[model samples]
Target: MSQATPTSQSQNVQTVTIEREMNEYGALTVHVDGQNATRHIVEYASDELKTILRQLPSGSSVPLTIEPIGTRGNAWRATSLTQ
Candidate 1:
């Protein structure tokens, strides 16, 4: 038997702000605002995305295309960013 990998489903573009914080485990975590005022943690981010996030000031929102990651789909990753 073989286990199947989870496919990444790109979500609609949305305007959101990002923040970096330390989780309970003391690891750095990046969070973004989702639709309906929901908040999601980014488990994976590309180098480009990281650069953009770093340049953004606090509470700055930008248009981005994100995709849900992980089997539970509780985490997200930035696929595209529009400054």
Candidate 2:
């Protein structure tokens, strides 16, 4: 038997940019751009994005996901990039 995969328009897109900032709670403000990026917020932040910042090249685009953690905040989690 053969299996099929679910279709999702929000998959496989790569990051165009990522930035980190801080708020009163010491949260990370991450700005990421990707395919159909306009569908998302202007910019968001997360602890995960803070983890991967130095590892990534300045101005290098990476693959990530927009994760929502309720009251905590939203974050950009890097999984992969164009390379």
Candidate 3:
């Protein structure tokens, strides 16, 4: 009999700052330094992180740890966020 081993996906975490945008839909985006100018979306941010982000004023440069989603090299989601 042959058995298959399960593998876990590695997490890619990076510290970055939020780049707030002014529009109807309040979306969160961050730009990682030394990389392309593509804006990453914080789609899967935690509640605590989301609350902290929401309180911050526009154009705020707060450091945060973000994890990129599947296949999205430029897209990101906050894992650990602090003001």
Clashes of each: 0, 1, 0
Q: Write the per-residue lDDT of candidate 2 for residues 1-83, one digit (tens) a residue.
A: 45333234334344556354333443433444634342222233445544554455445455554433223333333333334
Query: Cα deviation of 7 in candidate 3 (Å)?
Result: 11
The whole-model lDDT of each prediction reads 0.55, 0.41, 0.55
Question: Compared to the true structure, candidate 3 yields what TM-score?
Answer: 0.55
lDDT (tens digit, per residue) of candidate 1 on 1-83: 55444354346467776554425432223345554444454543576665655566656677777666655645656667765
Name model 3 segments beyond 4 Å from true: 1-15, 22-26, 33-36
- CA-only RMSD, every prediction: 4.5, 8.8, 6.3
Pairs of residues clashing in candidate 3: none
Q: Candidate 2: where is the Cα deviation over 4 Å?
A: 1-16, 21-28, 34-53, 75-83
Angstrom error of the Cα, residue 82, model 3: value is 5.0
lDDT of 3 by residue, 1-83 (tens): 55333223434444445567523354666655556654555454466666766676655665565555655366556666544
